[model samples]
Target chain A: MVRPGGRSARVQASVHAAVRELEAEVGREALTVPLVATRAGVTPSTIYRRWGDLQELLSDVAVERLRPETAPEDKGSLRSDLEAWAEQFLEEMSAPTGRAYIRDALLGGPDGTNAGQCSAYAAEQIDVILDRAADREENAPDVETVLDRVVAPMMYRILFRPEGLDTAYARQLAVGLVGSNDR
Target chain B: MVRPGGRSARVQASVHAAVRELEAEVGREALTVPLVATRAGVTPSTIYRRWGDLQELLSDVAVERLRPETAPEDKGSLRSDLEAWAEQFLEEMSAPTGRAYIRDALLGGPDGTNAGQCSAYAAEQIDVILDRAADREENAPDVETVLDRVVAPMMYRILFRPEGLDTAYARQLAVGLVGSNDR
Candidate 1:
């Protein structure tokens, strides 16, 4: 039996596929709703109704691409787990394409739901790390603190200054948080 | 001397004044570039050329308005100063109008220069607090740490999950940083 959003998922898949193909062919600058819709076998109105506009559609696709497909790596300790997770987070988010995706995620209009979804992904990873710490009886900071201390700074640097983001910087934040919190 | 950007400054002032007046009268939805140009006594081309378009003009003005006009209030100690600054920052950034301005500021096209300017304002305030701490010989987190620990979290909360942002929460971040860093 098909799930509730099966048809919708198919449409989204086709649309995303169309975008990738067109991007590779003519590039992002020359893309439009009609062209993408034609390639995806959906009407232009459908694209507009669902995604609001071409830019939002592109942002939706990019944000979806950014969704983590697998759990963060297990590094045996809370500190190492956080460091590894944060390093991957910074690497993916600090690249040029990643930066564009981050920017577009926030620009999801007044509701700003896309940015919230992105934050939730980070929070989930932190929770996993915290759970590992719990199992090991190791001290740990709360997920909120991890978000505030590690993830926020990386994202802040990515969006604004956008320089000097590296594994060392990411590891520093994790180590500092772990040190202060005894986690 | 008139200064290099004299005419540009006047145009910006008149345009800003026009936006405020029109926002109060006709409301934001009804605003158009030609209408603002006529009101500000400049040609539409001037507004378009300088600001790119109506949305860009509106964003430029909002970012300009968001710029800090004065130095952060000094409270003698680094902890108090950071707490005060962070609380004020969260309050301003989480407010409805402030949120809109921030969104627009980042939406300032590909360069994202407005976001950079906003970061500079916070960094400058942080520097002042650090300098004060230095004078008092109080151990203090560096400017980057302050940006990471306090300001980044506040901004992340503001942009993503905007609820539950308040003075107490802001104070907690500042106080926690000080406790950790011996400042």
Candidate 2:
């Protein structure tokens, strides 16, 4: 079965299972190849052959978590679209696992390149929100600035602190960011 | 000299020298107390006697780097104050060592507490701009949003990339962020 071929379905399944187990036990730090192999009952060489290193494996895993569910589908108006976007960001801030993954990505260790991936994800999300305000081209800068300053900080405060994401704060951010008129 | 006594000037100098050398050589990862002591030509006992551990030593070094320069005496208007802030931020982004130190402080290590120190530094810098805006509190939130989205990213791009700090981009960010006010 091991004739210099790609990983078998069974092997892939085992590796996926091992990654979850390792993450649960020691978080991102323990996602090393040797650890994953040991947990999966596979040799280190098998992992190395399938995925070059832990980063490649972790990148794949991290990408899987990048769901676009938060990007509003057609909120009818620019204001509502922005509110939805801010709400999604707040949801991410409230979830411990979401915060942990972000911190891990930013920490830039064995998986430092993950920062770029995460940044790209954020940029894309921002693009979607900005798209709604494009017809009112004068509002582009204001929309972008609000998203970064007000909306973004709400996520950041909760991410860095032990406190839960505050709904009132999120509401304040959305309204202030998407003010009644153009900048 | 190594006995239990009050801290001395010579010991402080050695610690600073050790920190500078440690950061120059291996960034922040290899900044252990033993490593600092060996490089400083001081015994580990002497080093340990001075600072509790790597974190304590690093935090002190960070504080020294964060001492604020005097803000412009009077930049004429709020726009000028913001433009000056962007220029100052750009200057720090221009230095390779400064950029690396800030990144490490912000992203932090495997433990994740270092980022907090970095955030505090950023908050202080942001406060300076905020206080300046408070001088004319009409559009403080708007000013802050611009700083967060535009000025901050320009610094990050310039510092972390091969392009170095972009003076033109800084100017654009400052101007765009605080457009020709209704004045």
Candidate 3:
């Protein structure tokens, strides 16, 4: 769908795209507003006047791009639903673009501002899966419980550990969380 | 306990201590070899000859410092053992010295070298707890499973989320991992 508004919206899109592209190319640490402006075909003055500084610009870009690209789908059971959600979540998180956004948000963007947005986006997607699962079962684990048991561990490995995350890892995690509750 | 070796051992201990002190003071980003050498009362040439780079030096110091201070005690059951381990782990990790070591390991040190050492250290401690629990009960969850269920999420929150980690969080995590297997 076409984004609303005219020149200003176009500029925003261009700048955001440029920031992501540069992040992918150079990594977040090497990113600069002047470099981003040059890539977006916008002036440094416009970037500075609009975003204030590199941290704010990165935060805004992360908030925009780090959201789930597509809505999570509902599967019949909680196990299947969680697995599907986690698979998609892991896939997005492991991608270069997603990695760039997360790296910047965690490392460079202001305190919790951008990182919280990323966490919120994941939580929102997980909530959709959990809600669907609750309809089929007598009881469903709360979001915080699910987060602590499943999502947080997966995220920790993704960000810190050298172990690779795949659909199998996602399935195991989903099974661990959901299977334990079967009794 | 007195570490073995002669002048080399003393020099190594002094240099490691200086690196930890400076890291706690200014953080890893502001750390430099010359600064560390000066603080350690050693020449820059000695530092360069010994470690080659700041990352190498930090990794060595991190490896030496990040080890668990003492063996985790066996607490009869998996739940109590895990809770005790997590409590000590969280307390150490949240301390300024622990935070400095972790920060340097995660951010400034080489790719997997130092970070892997830190992870291995935690894994070793967790293994001891799990082994004791296993002797008490058949089919105890393995270290990997326990880590995914208990430790990963806690570490994610500690490193990324703004929330403080306390003994209560540790107890909850231990319970979640151990209590689920009671079917």
Q: Choose the strongest candidate by TM-score.
A: 1
What TM-scores do the predictions have? 0.90, 0.68, 0.78
After superposition, the stretches of candidate 2 with alpha carbons farther than 4 Å from their true spots are A1-17, A26-32, A45-60, A67-73, A109-113, A126-165, A181-183, B1-13, B25-32, B41-63, B69-74, B94-96, B107-119, B122-165, B180-183
For model 1, residues A1-183, the per-residue Cα lDDT tens digits are 325579888888899899989988998889999999999999999888888888788877777878898988888888788889999999999887788787778877668778888888888888988998999989898998889989999988888767667789999999988955543
Off by over 4 Å in 1: A1-5, A179-183, B1-5, B179-183
In candidate 2, what are the lDDT values of residues B1-183, reduced to their tens digit? Answer: 443343566677777788887787797776788888888778888866766667666755664575556644456566666666667767775565555555544443334455455445555665666676677663654533654555445533432222434566666666666666615
TM-score of 2: 0.68
DockQ of every candidate structure: 0.72, 0.21, 0.45
Q: How badly does each model clash, as a count of residue pairs?
A: 0, 0, 0
- For residue A107, give model 3's deviation from the true position in Å: 1.0
Name the lDDT value of residue B161 in candidate 2: 29
Per-residue lDDT, model 1, residue B114, is 78
* DockQ of candidate 3, scored on C-alphas against the true complex (2 decimals): 0.45
lDDT of 1 by residue, B1-183 (tens): 325579988888899899989988998879999999999999999998888988788878887788888888888777788888888888888888888888877878678787888898889888988888899889987888888988888898888767677889999999988955543
Q: Which of the predicted structures, 2 or 3, would earn the higher DockQ when compared with the native?
A: 3
Worst lDDT 10-window in candidate 2 chain B: B155-164
